[model samples]
Target: MSSEAASGMDVDGGAGRGGLTTAERTTIAAAVNAVLVHCQMASNDANFKAAIRARRKLLALPTTAQCLDVAAISDAVLEVCYAMGCGGFPWATPRWWVKRRTGGTWEDLRQCDDATDDYFKEKLRMSPRVFREIQETLSPLLQRRVTFYRVPLQPDHIIAYALYRWATGETYDSGTCSFGIVRASGITMVHDVTAALLTACPDKISWPTGLQKAVVLRAFADKGFPNCHGCIDCTHIYIDKPANANGEDYCDRRRRFSVQAQVVVDMNLRVLDVFVGYPGSVHDMRMLNLSSLWVRAESGQLFTGPPVMLPFGVRTNGYLLGDNGYPQSEWIVVPYGGLAQHPTKARFDNKQKTTRGAVERAFGRLKGMWRLFLRTHKCNMDSLPQQFVAVCILHNILIDAGVPFDDNLLWEVGPDGVRRRVDLGMHQPLRPVCMESSTGDALILRDALAERMIAQ
Candidate 1:
């Protein structure tokens, strides 16, 4: 007999009906109590409090919900949604690819097993509910008809579970089917749904000029940040190595080498722009140089050609906030530290230095939330950065949808008893530093001309 059976303990414990002796029952109860006691003790810890706060802030929602029962089928559907948001299974296609490339031609398909197609189809069949949900979500986003195209087991749940496990560094099974569908099906369904959701940008996202100014201004002056337009930065994510032909081109610029991405966010920590899937080896300055942002702004086409009123501050060759990675110019202002400052220019330099700190806080919020950037991602290099951009886009959607944020709950007393504005972008400090004292007061006198350009 096995050790468990020989000991007279129930071997059918997994099914939760193992008849056991009084001693066995006591051991199990003690084990359960130990876990509860440990948790109760840890709950009072300062680190746990900080963790709870950080989690609440990161999820952008309260965490007062109860534990989901095993039979909560609708809750399972939400779990499926979580799976979809994570990247779907990656290995399924490759094994299929190899078999197709060498084993048989498409004309001789009947002879070939074609495991990939069957696998994906089976996954879809098992999770009809999730598949249907994904289709529903995708239909509105794609602006095209989406009929269920089933494939064999994508093993999507396995991928999702693995990713979640890696991210949280916790043990979990992608193979668990708490939902109506099988584990793999649940995962596959969620991936499709997430893709659909990211593509679902509203027809009219309110980009009110007044609102932008108000929100930004509050996040800056009230929030103790500088150069308050928004925060800008780039990050990289790792994935499965690309095919040999495209391998070198796909390699990213990190310790482990992954695909890089660029994101721009407003002071409210809402993502405004995402430029993703560039090779990792490229520097931040290089990425910026190639970005559409650089293209539009550098060419002076932003204001002259179109009536696109750029966010925050007036045009007349308006300035952009950036870190030390960018080149210094009248249009794009970098932090004035290190050798960039001369002793004679200290007064004006201090002002510029003071304002640029907002972008740093913005970066802090971005990294603090989606910690996928905190460490290496273990998946396909090409698709990882795209996934990162997708997450940021999702974050922006949540923010737009009025999810609670840290600044929303916590209020700070501003200098001079001033209330910080969070309703719109009001807190951004005034720019055009040092120029106020320039020759002929030309920049100041010309400020009127600049206003005319802005009104245009």
Candidate 2:
């Protein structure tokens, strides 16, 4: 029984109860003081024993002639004993306290006003409407993956918890409190939501092909980067040093352990493809070569159309804009490194840098909206890649929903003409391989494009 009930203090009663005579109140006050004094002088173990004896003695006190109420005196003495750390009262657990603190009202949070909605967007990285739409879209898959017979979690609550953790970069324990869930359940929800996004959203994040490729090229042409299909770059997602023997492989040039992710983004800042799970130590160029997108492009399967025609009667396949770290190819254009030697080369480099900023801006928007990528995730190394890809998918979804970019967070080029934010250490330029005819043709096309830009 609860201490209040055992002591005959009505558990539902407020601070005020039936009035006690002055003499009865004085007697109860004396008993409480004596209990406190004994507890203060005793060790924890001794005090617990004394409290038990005191409780029994107080409960057996007579309540007839002297108006000595056993119930009131017992309640007073137990309160003193618990305060002194003798530990007879039933205190609320941490989960119970959290529930009380948050009032378990997640639905109310979803229906907040504009100011509160903005705050939620800042905290959760998406507006309530977007979050709800995603939840509804992925509910079927998530329901199959995550189920509880008792205390079933709402799909929106699970997705919200995951987004909150990603947006705020908070630990699961702290993140769950806002959603009225325990830490273990929060972790499960994050995993399930991430899996659901991966399964449900890949169709929305396709590589540009056919008419899509034409549309993408037109967008690039409008930006003064004709024949460009997308911008390619790589960033590292920091992670805990793996506990396994191969941990050293994950350490990057900055001496921080991480997983590398390569992204291909369109002018709209939507991710076309993401290749994750490479070690941070791997060079960006190497990761690119290893990606499926590269394999498909190399096989002439990524973009299908008539070749793009440039000045001087030069024609070539659509190419992606990349930094010097990537080797120049018929399908990948890189800026000339000797820009200082010629005004034409300098102009070409400037245009290339400006165009390639799409990928940098995409990365900036991604890491800015979901700050989890900005810090080390305390998850198993094998599972981290899936989570990273899931964030990229979510990023594309938000862009599709017309979420405006925070222009203040856009990436800027440094004085050295490189993106200033070093998400991963700068990659050394890849050495030119013996040119296949296609690669030689790509170099020729790059020079032709530079000449074309100069003449313009």
Q: Model-by-model lDDT, in order?
A: 0.43, 0.73
The estimated TM-scores of all candidates read 0.44, 0.71
Superposed Cα deviation of residue 51, candidate 2 (Å)? 46
Q: By TM-score, who's the top model here? A: 2
Q: Which stretches of candidate 2 lie over 4 Å from their true place?
A: 1-108, 112-115, 144-149, 407-438
Q: What clash pairs does model 2 have? A: none
**lDDT for model 2:** 0.73
Estimate the Cα RMSD of every predicted model relative to the unseen true structure: 23.7, 12.2
What lDDT score is found at residue 344 in candidate 2? Answer: 78
Pick by lDDT: which candidate is best?
2
Candidate 1 minimal-lDDT segment of 10 residues: 64-73
